[model samples]
Target: MKLSKGLLADLRLQPELQVPDAALLALPEKVLQFGTGVLLRGLPDFFIDKANKQGLFNGRVVVIKSTSKGDTGGFEKQDNLYTQCIRGIDGGRKVSEDIINASISRVLTATTQWEEVLSCATSKDMQLVISNTTEVGIAYVEESIHNNPPASYPGKLLAFLYRRYQHFNGSEESGMVIVPAELIVDNGTLLKATILQLAAYNQLPTDFITWLEQHNYFCNSLVDSIIPGAANIDTGYEDELLIMTEVYRLWAIETDSPRVKEVLSFAGADAGVVLAPDINVFRELKLRLLNGAHTLSCGLAHLAGIDTVKAAMANDSMAAYIEGVMLHEIVTAITDKHIRHDAAVRFAVAVLDRFRNPYIEHKWVSICANYTSKLKARVVPALLQYQQHTDHVPALMALGFAAHLLFMKSPAADDPFAAYYADLWTQHPAETVAEKSLSDSNVWGTNLNTAVPGLTKTVTNMLLALQREGVNAYLERVAAEIIIS
Candidate 1:
């Protein structure tokens, strides 16, 4: 059978997918999730769905899409229904499909339902507010309260909190615990600060500020999952592609918010999510192991002419490049005990296995976008830490950085790196094409153009070779120079 809309409906109605209508739609209204993106569906929705099935949180999740560009017709068709496929990696084999279990209760485009969304924020039973609106979503805007429609994430949040403060008549119990999985350092604190900034800018009441500070709980969280939102099997069910992520999903909430732990019952030998004393440890591990390796591998994989991450992993040389970059370069730079040495190695090995999961078509583009932003998250920390501690740049991290620059300069068809670096090159456009285009210190942040030992020279030589030879030849040279050396 076809996994069409009708077929999916039948499947959801089946005993496994269907909890009693009462249980599924209990209207606890506790989960006010922002962003209808796949990560939220795959990560939080999966957990909430489990909690519902096991007679835990009776609340139905109400979703709000902060952006208007997401699916409208598809969400309208099924009353906001979709499927999440979980594919696990064990040894070298890919597991079977686990789909259709986690589906949305209601999808509200906040543009149309701003009032409804705000009302939920003030609802008596509402307790947990979750968001995944990308890193750029968080900001402070002055007109948050004055504007009929809020302009930014923090703006909308502040307005909601203000309303909730009024609705509760300053009751402390009505306050919520906000968890935003934006992969930002100090996400919760930054969000709170932005909200406060908005509050002050808008001249909101002191009572509201006091309520926000006193009652509300904003806990930082680190969420890691390879949720590549590209559906396979061409069902043509909706324009919104189904998402497949590794079964190794993890949620690390800060040591505080013990209530979140109790409410979710998230504890076990392999419970997947952990409540950590310092969420930063888990965050660093994710950045260095999962995200850093991914950033280091993307252009390399594309340069070697590979499509998906799995295919890249299948190619021995590409796989070796990934492993070597992690083991030699990136891992050497990590400072945290939880994320350094053996721990980093174990995580890197797991990430490799995740990369090779055949069931999940982890698209290069999924890991490819926000290259600059991702570098900040993953590589820059290690660079700063290692430089600060050792007082010398590590070789592997430098090599990975050089490799990123080299691929960016390559002018090859089917070159993913070309498009990635197009903007930077277009702005700079290597003067004379003979002298290595990116000699500009701006791109490298420092005079890394000349400062980092023989990096500029090495990268320039590789770029020249690529122009003359090809990606394969360039890879051979890099593999010999960086990987072998």
Candidate 2:
């Protein structure tokens, strides 16, 4: 008997990987990914992995972590390769699969090796740029300039594009299509605007702007995939990069041209990324129905003393509370009639199932991040929408917001849920929940408490109940008065 010392030998599913060594180790870099986080690794790499398996793209990807806090040393240590694991129902059976991603050739972090990053940017083979630096990660800092050693994401992008423009003497053929997977409204357009701002601030040549406008492709897209990051890389899953995720994936792109199809074909993602004229419609629908449910669930479940979604759903009363929040308060609030109602319901149910996936250990603390901001993006629209259709207050939704306000008022951690509200109420003393709501315009984009009749009273009452009886007990009172008939 003999033992192989190869790092990948012990991996349970390594034998299933069919990545050719030539494709895995040495292929022309056609993509420069700006962020090497879970989304790109899971979604885009899944596409590339499929494409390679189908013999569509033998091309390689060069991943660059475009932030000071992010480092690719771990990825590089694994030879710029990793695994993507998907777990969910497939054909009504619970199935899981592990994929060895061979699309990546190298990893570079801007802080440590800006030269390497810039060099990849200058390379003629690099044709596409993908990024998911999160919603807050893509903002422009006016002070950022080209003179800095390592710049902001847009600044770094600008430097890269300038190099590419100069590399081939401003040839239109050298220009690349950039698709950023940041979950912003019109992310590509916003990204290009920032890059153009950087160009103007740096006072780059007018031709550069023209080149950017004429040659480059900045396509807006919506990407959805639940990718749970590694608990610990050192977990004894040797040769296995544990990226737990749901089977669901979406990439809605706004581009009419054949370029997307061509690139998708070239990258082996022809099956995954969908091209449509109105990606925004789908984006809004998903954000409202899917993301909305997650936010409301957190507030409602937390008030019931339910920590994990699975635990929350196990309680029939809490589970019904979530459903009522979605169907009555949330879904009823959406103004757009075109959003598939049946699909939305199914999606909500699917999200619940995902939340209950026994193998996945999702902490409320993680999903509970950005709770205040999420309420605006996720829950409030439904609130406004419901009011528009029917002239009555959504009491359950009001109760959820009340839970959020009380949760904010209480001692809470700095996760997304508590941070903004904590900063708002704690920093500036307000006498009542309504006063807090009225003061923080950022939460609702306006004083919605005044606009919606009886909202403040409802929230105030709910807040009082929570304070007097504690969270779970208060929720029982709410269920008695609001949920239960």
Candidate 3:
């Protein structure tokens, strides 16, 4: 039988499978969700569902599908019900649990149901607005909100807020707590600015703008989860929206208002939902540790014949490089007044454990996608910081940096510098390629060659060595030397 509200009535329960209480199905739609992607379903929707099941936050998500990609047929067919398979390693133990999520009250496609979508703003119960419309979605487009639907995400949101203001007489309590789960830093802050800009462009009322500024809470947030879709486990029922996620999950919300916290009461249900005045600590830790480590190590690990993150963890040399670079360099470099050494170490250990999840076959090549951008954003800051504190080259960073340079030799078609590097490598020697690539200000925001003294030379030497000795031999040799020191 296919999973649906009707199927939930007679479905047999397993010890590991959690089926929501029938009462949860009757909850009010309290959240206005912008995207129907698995990330939102996997993280925010997951938390809300879990909370509702616990009788904590009695709410449901009203999803607005704005993308031109897929239709709402699957959701309608399934009664907006889906399954969540939370799996992988945690604290060095296996985790396998299934949840038939009943968080979504309804799914409305914005194109056809713009009126209905706007109608959600009239719901007095709606207090939270959650969105994950990719990074590009939260952009400014000078389009009219008066159209059947607004042209941009911000426009649509402004229209919704305006409708709410009209319905509630611009009550201070009626404004939503907007939490954007886009990967970009300061997503909430930026989205709010864009919306305010659109409001001006549309010549919106000063009173409405006043209400927007005073009542609404746009919270900067960070969400981390390895939620690959659909585990395809036999549950005696089929679910089209099944999502498989790892044991680790975090949704760090930056908010100051107690009212916002009260509205986001679902946060209490999971340790993963952290509410704070500022989330930069979480942001820095995640970006510099988990993502940065991935960016730094992927090329080297892939070139060393390692296909997956778990495989690299199982390998002695690669494992050493991964842990060493993170603990000795990244953790040290990122340590500040807010970020202490012990805390960074703990986070690193957790990250390493996450990387060692035997069930998660995280592909190195997948991490290597958009290689140039990843290096520029993730590694460059850490590289500079590592040198700033120590004043000498971090051998592991240099090795990883070298591996990145080596990895970039066969330029990706999408890489802007692909042609530049293609011709550079074609025309020059390995040493020159290293210096030129590292020196290119466009590649990294700063000239890595001079900004961090001796970086260009060290990276160049390591790159040449990696080329001469092959990835495994060079990695093994350099990683051992770094470890010994």
Candidate 4:
């Protein structure tokens, strides 16, 4: 049978499967969501569904399809009902469950239904606004909010807020909690700044601007979950909105406002929703341990002919190399006065476990996307910091660097870093590649050869060794060097 509100009572499902209460289906739509992507559906909508099932947050979501590429046929067909398949390893235990999510009440197209989307501005029940419009969606564009549908995300948001300001006569109680789940750092601050700039560009009234500044709560949020979206998975029923995600979830929201806390009372029902004055620790831990380790090891794993992260973890040498890099080098380097040593250690251990999860097929090639920027941002800082603290070269990091150079030998057309290195490889001699790469200040932000005493020599030697000995034999040698040192 197809999953929908009407089939909730008749369907005889397993005991582990959670069906939403019939009463909660009649709940008021209180959240104005900006995108229909799986990340928001699998994380925020999942949390909202959980809370509503427990009768804590009696609210539904009104989703706005911002883009015009896809129609709302699937949502309309399924009555906004979907299945969430949670499959992963959490706390050293395997987790597998399916949930019928009834969080979204309706999906409206922003371009055609602009007035309907704006109608929520006058709704007293609409208390929260959430968005997950990728990393590039928060930029300031010269757009007029008076357009039926503004061009940019921030512009669309300002138009909606302007409607609310006009509807309520700039009342304080009508303000909404705005939380953006974009991966950029300080997303809320940047988003609010962009909205203010757009308002000024449109010559908005001073009183409405003042109301926006004083009344609204823009909470900085960091969300962590791997939602790979619907794949070829049988759920014993038809579900067009099926989304697959890991069991481990986190939504860290930074806010100190009493009204904000009161409106987000759903935090009381689930441990995954954390409200704090700051979420720096969560951000740092994710960036340094999970993202950092991925950036460092992706090249090496791919060069070793490992396709998926779980496949790399299954190989003993590759797994050991990943563990040593995170636990010994990356974790130690990231732990400073602000981060506790024990906390970093715990996070690193958890990261290793997540890597070994059998259900998540994290592709190494996907991690290698934007390779140069990732190395500069995620790996290089740890490499430099490790040298500063220990005064000894990180053997695993050097091997990873060598693997990156070799991986970049065959460049993609769009990748400028790979193209530059590929050109250098064709023009320069083999022995000079490392020196030239280390000295390119434009790439590394500093002359790595001079910044770290022996990095050039170490990288050059490792590069030569990798070419002569191949990836597996070279990794074995790196493992032996770590053991010996």
- On lDDT, the leading prediction is 3
> Model 2 scores what on Cα lDDT?
0.71
The estimated TM-scores of all candidates read 0.78, 0.80, 0.95, 0.95
How far is 136's C-alpha from truth in model 4 (Å)? 7.5
Candidate 3: the clashing residue pairs are: none
Per-candidate Cα lDDT values, in order, are: 0.67, 0.71, 0.88, 0.87
Please list all clashing residue pairs in model 1, or write none if there are none.
Answer: 329-396, 329-397
Worst 10 residues of 4 by lDDT: 10-19
- Name the candidate, 3 or 4, with the larger lDDT value: 3
**lDDT at 203, model 2:** 86
lDDT accuracy of residue 264 in candidate 2 = 55
Over 220-286, each residue of candidate 1 has an lDDT whose tens digit, in order, gives 8888887877667443344353667677788777755556565544233236667766877676677
> Which tens-of-lDDT digit does each residue in 438-475 have in candidate 4?
79989989988888888888989989988999988988
What's model 2's lDDT at 382? 76
Ranking by lDDT: 3, 4, 2, 1
